[model samples]
Target: MKEDELHAFLTLQRIPNLGDTSIKRLIARFETAQQVLDQKKESLLKLDGIGAFKLKAFFEKEHRLAAEEELKFIQEHNIDYCSYKDQNYPERLKHCIDGPILLFKRGSKDFSQQRMISIVGTRKVTNHGVDFIKQFVEDLAPLNPLVVSGFAYGVDITAHRAALDQGLDTIAVLAHGLNQIYPKVHAKYVKPVEAQGAFITDFWSSDAFDRTNFLRRNRIIAGMSEATVVIESAEKGGSLVTADIANSYNRDVFAVPGRPGDAQSLGCNNLIKTQKAQLITSAADLIYLLNWQIEEELKPVQKQLFVELNAEEKVICNFLSDVGKEQLDLIALHCKMPTFKVASILLNMELKGVVRPLPGKQFELT
Candidate 1:
């Protein structure tokens, strides 16, 4: 949008009582934010869902001033933004009633075309949770889905790192403005994230950082994705909130089932029991339920074991390639290597994300 148009949308966003949905309604009737602002109270009050209270603060001059200030900060920082009405707005988010009218971003990603999955969980993640996320991401890599998550601790960071590691595009839905990164420690991963995807938000540079910001941000995470997955969650937490939002949007919701007695699993189990989310054991179940086809080329993370493998590792990989999954002993025997030596090589391969160890001493390419 041009400067005046962008400023008008930002001005609409800055109004206190006027929310995205109401603003969208007003914009629909008047055709533009500027026109809406120019409209008379008599005409505005005549519109459905429009009342005197909603417009009480609508004509405040400070709204436009705040918008201009935010626009200046955006330009100064070189932040990229998109209007909800613009063709470049997130396609799935367009379906949401309360989707933000203006979204700020910094990165090269274009959500104009993509398959996104929002993965959220407690910051206090378990070892099992990490393993599940990594493996699930690896399995989903073939379809090349853009993983979406908050840039918080545990599952969010793990999901983002795993996606970048797989060379998949990912988007971090931020709770605050683009000018800052939350949980300052997560700062290290920002560059890599931006290189591969982006950090998107609706807050202006001057907006206050508050706990409520997270709940509001969850909608975008849920709104933009085709599905929302809860890797782990306590009985009450943000991930569950995200699942609720996804369900409200009529998006597919999946939660990994954990032991009933486990504290972190309680939320997911409840979701399953309540039928708020589908129970998925792995990415395969999610893929099947969503009917997502692997239309893109298989990512290296999905197929290649090692970008450049050692001769011994290559021998084992080739053997597995020829004979398919086999027991460690069988693999060692067939490759003409001692059991101890083969075991060590396989362990190294697993660390490099080339192989996955299975039950009964079996192994297979990741």
Candidate 2:
């Protein structure tokens, strides 16, 4: 965003009682934060959800000054930001009504992709949880998934490291400002995180770190991803909060079930019992459930030559015929089929000798 526009957004963020939803509403009415800020109090108060109390800080010089200060901090730190309207802003988050108006992103990473999954759980992660995360992330590496987490201790950092070990990008959704890393011990992982992924937050350098910040941060972690997975959690934890937020956003949620007697398992168990999240034991289950698997075996052309395909298979066969040989992932992506379902159909087609798998995981008509 341009400096003047960035300044305007920062100023809007500084406005009290004006939340992301309200700011978005104001934007819809006025087009830009600068436009909204420039309007007179009488004009602003006329809009729905706008009130005198919310606009009490309107026309205040302090807000402008604060925005300028934040902007300077951003520039000095070489920080980057994306407004909600920007093309680079997360697509999933864009659909969230309460997503941050201005999101600050650091490092070489991309959140716009559809493969990101938020993995959150308790700070007191168990041996089973650690093992599960490592094996699961390693297995999920084939999908090139972007792991999202809070970058805290236990499950958060585990997910980050697990993804990193698999050479997959992982994002840290921080509860505090980028100016400082919380739980200072996790500071060691910062450079590595920046190398492979990034740290993102909507908080300003001047914002104080607080417990409630985790709740706010949870929204970003939950909102940006295709799914949220709880590896392990106690009865009450931030991971559950993220799960609830993800469900509210209508995103898929998964929980790793634990033995009934385990303290750390209570939250995930409850989520399954309450039907809030699907149960997933391993990476394959997750891949199948999330439709990330690709079609492997397809029938040769001989089978389709003799037996006509249904409408769906016709779409897939026609697409493959046009594209020549195609990767299953690309086929699924282009044909708009869930990877698992398409894979199964391709397997059936393979048995029929209508399509054949080639070297390097490509599929072509036989």
Off by over 4 Å in 2: 295-366
**How many clashing pairs per prediction, in order?**
0, 9
In candidate 2, what are the lDDT values of residues 1-366, reduced to their tens digit? Answer: 789999999999998888999889988999988898889888987888877788788778899999999999999999989999999999999999999999998899977656899999999999989999999888676557899999999999999999999899999998887899988999899999999999999999999989999999999999999999999999999999999999999999999999999999999999999999998877756765765643332111334446767888788889988989997778889989877567656655655567776755567877
The TM-score of candidate 2 is 0.82
How does each model score on TM-score? 0.81, 0.82
The candidate maximizing TM-score is: 2
Q: Listing every candidate in turn, what is its Cα RMSD in Å to the true structure after a full C-alpha superposition?
A: 8.0, 8.6
User: lDDT per prediction?
Assistant: 0.87, 0.87
Query: What would the per-residue lDDT of candidate 1 be over residues 243-305, giving only the tens digit for each residue?
Result: 999999999999999999999999999999999999888775675567554442343334453
Would you list the clashing residue pairs of candidate 2? 298-350, 299-349, 299-350, 299-354, 299-355, 300-353, 300-354, 300-355, 301-354
Score residue 20 of candidate 1 by CA lDDT.
Answer: 95
